[model samples]
Target: MIQQLLINEIDLHVQAILQESGVERPSTLKILTEHPAHLEHGDYSSNIAMQLAKIVRRAPLQIAQDLQARMEKNGRVQGLFRKVEAVQPGFLNFYLAWDTWAQRAEQAAQSLGGIGKNTKVLIEHTSINPNKAAHVGHLRNSCIGDSLSRMLAHAGYEVEVHNYIDDLGNQLADTVVGILHTRTEESFDRFGDFCWETYAKINQAYKSQPELAEQRAVVLHALESGKSNLAWMGNLVAERIVREQLEEMKQFGIQYDVLVWESSIVNAGFWDTTFELLSQTDMFHKVADGKLAGCWVLKNREDEAVAELDNAEHQGDKVLVRSNGILTYTAKDIAYHLWKFGLLSNDFVYKKWGAGLWSTSSQGSKKKIGHADMVINVIDHRQQYPQEMVKLALQVLGYEEAASQLKHVSYGVVSLSPDTAAGLGIAISDGKSSYAMSGRQGIGIKVADLLDHMESVIEAKRSKKTGISSRTIAAASIRYYLLKYQLQTEVILDLEQATEVTGNTGVYLLYAYSRANSILDKAKKDARVLHLEPDFNVSLLEEQEYPLLRHIAYWPETLAAATQQLAPSLICHYAFELAALFNHFYSACPVLKGSESSIRHRLWITQIYKQTLQQALELLGMPTPNRL
Candidate 1:
């Protein structure tokens, strides 16, 4: 907020300077403010003068000097900035009035509020198919989704998270068929783990026997029919497995508002209604005579280059329904999204799931829940095509606003490092960067197993003096590890690196917070630091202290940028940098043993750093351990 105020003052002075120079101010001037790479340049720098050079036909340095002179004469700028300087070439660097900024930053941190506009957001994530135990790849999706949800909620949005259950899909059908055929004497504590092994075995068996494929079809038909004994058995398996998966997710602090079953959409006739709606438009048509004969298809509206191909035979389209009259997953997704945006007339019957959660049912209490102003689907990168088709379907139905509001938050898959792969007994090929996980191959680390190992490793390193439990530490470590990377960056889980207590890990951040607490706790009892007031002299803060305070002041800006770009990694980067800066400051400056004024100022700065770090960690869904 303070940074924004400073930027506004600078923008006004730049505009005044342009008018005096007989240069028309550009209608669109982007007033950007960023911290200089080196602290000596200034606390904040703007390059608007450089951008104006081409327009005003002057050297950037000359423009920057003119703006700096005009800003110096402005009364408002004097209150916020110590000195405004025109650096080499074009940049306008503004040094903060340390006292004013310190007070403002302290106030801002204390009174931070939600940045949302009260618009409703529906985020559907962790929609793992309820056929197998959740793997490491699934953990990535859940961690990202849960963190984003927390960030949005912190920003004051009315957020509803839904976990879409693909219970009627082929994967579940295969698992069901396997359960029917396979006889096992092993006692299983969790049914989902049993299904995980059986699912892989069934796929492997189909590779050789080939006749097992027909059983999958039979099970699929039964699932679609929804009333036969086999269908009931499939539903039971899905229900049990989903419960197990939910338990695992609970360990990672993931929860959902609704459990939307694919079978509910089919049995509730929502797809039938969607079919009638699609029939009225030109978007869907039956291919009369081609490789896609009798299949109803939706025209591809995504890529214009592909759509404009003069050769009609080269045009690619999405199949909505097969020739056998079975609807594709894309069709069901379209129907589901229609319900999400409240475009369809049909609604689902809801039943209470958990304490405050809801689930769709064929026959239950009728409740309205799916309508949302914006829909964000946190699916993997592999679902780009189907996601696009879902959006295109909304556009085709004349809901351009809804189509624009539909966001597909796609992320890359998680893989394993070489050492980790070898530790897990998974062999990797010679020339690969990482070993990819596959649920069908049973080659991925199960989420429960990963948690167990992480807790064990953390427990071995944790000291008896610390009050934090191993489970809590492991959760924080893994959640932070999973979220620290950019969405497009392929994350290779290395157990050694993830559990380490140093260098940008979640454990390090937690330890930093705990260290601050220890310092403040000691300061409270020391006669030299106990009587310090909040009104400490800012002049005593050392060179290293300025950067820490500056970084703390940039919290709002960092959060705004991360929210605007829909990237949580920005927050991750900011937290790590803040922790590193605090660590450097701690090493260079003595807190309780300094002069009275110096100790007081340093203690306040440490407190601000701790509060800021705690907020950042919370945004990433990592709990701050009091002792680590």
Candidate 2:
């Protein structure tokens, strides 16, 4: 609120000066304000004078002086800024008045949430093949998806989250064939882990025995048919693995609104409906007399028409169906997005999975879901091609605006350090700093195992167990570690660094929050420390306290930026910086032992800091512990 007021006052004065000099003001004379790095640079600085130098044909310093003269006489500017200085080469610096800062502390009227009040945003993520245990890469996807859900909902958007389950994929078909052919070599507690090892063995056998590879294709056909006993076995295995994965996600506080099974879309003939609609468009074609003959495909772009359309690879076109009548992954994806944006006349059957949770079924009652203004898919960077194919299909069908609203949030995959890989039982024979994780090869850490390992390491470092559980700290550590890096950055998972409490990990932020709460709690006990009077002197706040106060009031702007970018790492960055500022303020200023006004104002700063950090933590899907 204070920032915008400063910007508006400066802009108004700039216009008056432009009019007085008989110069037409430019419509794009934007006023940009940012926090000065040091207190000596004043509270906020802008270069409006430099922006107007060319328009007025005057020196920047002279124009800045004129702007300062007009702003000093304005009553609004005088109330908010103690002085407005025109620096060399044209810079406007505004030092916030003491009364304005005090008013901000007493009652801050800054909020930019609820901007998306009536819109609906649908997010699809964590669509792991339901044939094995989830790896750390899957955990990273879930964290990003769940945190985005929490933030968009907090921003007052009707958010619907979906977890697409590919039960009919080749991965599940491979697992089913393995289960039927091989006997149990060893006893196992969890079914997913057994499937994990068996999957690798089946792939190895397929290479040695060509007949087994042909049998794998037959199993895939049966799974897609959804009728035979083999298909039933596939379904049973997929449901069990999905349940186990959800249990692992619950450890990190991630939940979804809907579970969309690919089988449901296939069985209900939803894709058939979409296929009929696509056949009427010019972009959809049946290739003839070439390598891509006997296939239905979509052109890359309308303008990229070639003499021979059969060469799809050369033109970047995508074949939706093969000669043997099998739909590709991108084909199914296009149909699902059509349903998501309410372009399809048909809808899926829904069944209640749990409280406030629903799943798509072959046959069930109806419920309102999946009609959204915007759709976001959180997939890894490797799937960029297929994701774009789906979006282009939407545009080809004449839904240009809806296609524009579709977004693909691509992120980098997760890898393991050499020591971490060796700890996971991978034989690290060659010297290497990092290793890529392969779930099929059984070389990656399972979600359950990772949580267990993190919890044990945290407990080992603690002198004793406190009231709070180590599970909470473990989740915080993992989520924050995965989210601190920018999107599209391949992260190398290191257990030791993630569990460190002194660094910029989630555990460090939790400790800072706990410290502030302890100070506030102790002050509340002793009624003599802070005078609960309505008014307190802002001049009593020391120089160090200003940074903390400024950050505490910036929660709204921080949230807005994170939400706009659909990046949770921004929130993590803000929380870490806020915690550091609070720590610095605590070391430099006295809260419990000072003048009554100073104590009151300092405690207010501490309380607001705790509240601001808590909001940021929750947005990143981290647990806020009062004590750690």
Candidate 3:
């Protein structure tokens, strides 16, 4: 808000000068986005003179001198700048009054709004496939999705998050076949585990007898037909695994406002409209001859290059509808996206299925939440081409409005650690296997098991702390671990690094917060709180107080940056920096026995700092424990 006021007032002065000069393109209202390392010039600096130099046909320094003369002539030069220096680069540096920074620092600590006044936005994430156990790779996707959603919401947007479930795919069919081949009876409770085993077994089986490829083809055909036994089983398997995965996501506080089911496209007849639209546009055609005869296809956008090849014999189209008259997964996805943005001129009759477990709104509440204005698919980067094709198909079918809004938040894969001794290497029957984490393979680590194990380790660490309770440590530790890294960066998942209460980990932050809380709790009963007054002089803040004040001053800017960038790592980084600064302040400075009344009052204000930091950390899903 201070920056806003400064920019607004300064802009008014510049505009008035430009009006008087009758000059256009004077670079008025220029922003000085200088980094702090350039503070040798000023906190804020601008090259407005350089911008106007060409217009005036004079040196930048001459232009700056004229601008300064005009401001003095208008009698608007008093009490603004501490000094103005013109550097060789034609940059004019303005040193603000020192008290300005003091006021800004105080405002940061006490301001009610961390999120600036910004436009409403809807952010979607974590649209994991509902056909298998959640893996580290899926963890990357969900983490990025949820963190970005939270960041946008914090930045003053009415963010509505969605998670789509691709419940009716060939992979789901394979799981069903696995269950049918392995299980004696249908069991919804064990369906997830059953699918997991089936996916791996079926894949391995296919490797030995390539004829099983035919079985997979049959399963795919059955899925598209809708009434096949495999289709029915696929539904059951998808529903069951969705339940299990939802429960897993619950531990990490990931949730969705809308549940867009891929299967619902068929049930709701959205695909029929999609096909009709494509056919009307001539975007799709029925093949007349060659290997893909009797199929409907779309010219693969990439095949135009093959057409230019000198000796290319037969690079063909991507089959939208296969020889058996079933649509490919890509075809169905196009319809699904069209329906998501309400561009199909149709809508699905949604049913309240279970309270989807992966949703925060579903937690401690029985009712289901539905309907979204926007949809985002948090899929892997490998699907970029397919998702792009889906968007193209929509545009070609005259759904340009919806196509414009469709978002595919593609994320990189969570690769396996080359080190064999990685954290609790994926569970396998024969040996510890990383392959279990693959949805296609269906052998993988369950999120619940991982959380339970982490919770146990954190609890044990808390017990070792002399006075801290088990619950406090566990909550703090889990929340910290989830947010320690930037979402885009792959977490190496070193157990020791994640579990350590030392270093840049969340536990260290919790301890810092706890130290502050402990100090204030005891101070409240003593004369410190009794004699505290609101007239605390900020100038009395000394030594470590400077860094504490500086860090606290950065909260608003840091928060705004995070929200704008849709990255929570900015906040994570700030939390650690602030915590580290406060820890140093706590060690070196004595709050209760300061030298002067001003010092005492300033020390008390650090309590406000502690409270604010604690609140911000919680927003990042990090905990601030009251005791170490």
Per residue, candidate 3 scores C-alpha lDDT tens digits across 156-262 of 55566666777666677676666655443545445555566667787777777777677767776676567867777666777778777766666666666666676
- The number of clashing residue pairs in model 1 is 0
- Model 1 lDDT tens row, 1-628: 7677777887887777677778887778788888898988988898988898887788999988988887777754747788889988789998888787766675574333556666788999999998989998898899888888888887777889999999889999989878877666777668888988888888888888788899988988889998799899988988988888888888888889899999889887888898898888877778787577788888875532213333233346777887899988889999999999998888899989888799998878987687888898888888887898898889888999999999998898899889888876776668577898777777778888888988998888877735678888788888888888999888988878877867888888888888898898888887766778645476686777878888988898888777767788899999999999999999999777757777778888888898899888888888776676
Whole-model lDDT per candidate: 0.83, 0.83, 0.61
Superposition-based RMSD of candidate 3 using all C-alpha atoms, in angstroms: 5.9
How well does candidate 2 score on lDDT at residue 489?
92
Order of candidates by TM-score, top first? 1, 2, 3
TM-scores, in order shown?
A: 0.94, 0.93, 0.78
- Enumerate residue pairs that collide in model 1: none
What value does the lDDT take at residue 66 in candidate 3?
A: 63
Better of 2 and 3 by TM-score: 2
Clash totals for all models, in order? 0, 0, 2
Q: Could you give candidate 2's per-residue lDDT for residues 1-628 as a string of tens digits? A: 5666677788788778788789887777798887888887787888989999998889999988888888887754648678888999998887777666666643442254566788999999888999988888899999999999988888888999999999989899888888877566688779888988888777777777767777778889889888999889998999999989988888898999999999888887778998999999988888785667787878888445422455433346688887789998889999999999999988999998887789999878898899999999999998988888889989989999889999998999898888888888877798877899885667887888888888888888777577478888888889898898888998988767756767798778888988988888788778796345424467676778788776765666677778889999999998999999999999998678766777777777777777788888888988777677
Instruction: Supply candidate 3's per-residue lDDT for 239.
Output: 70
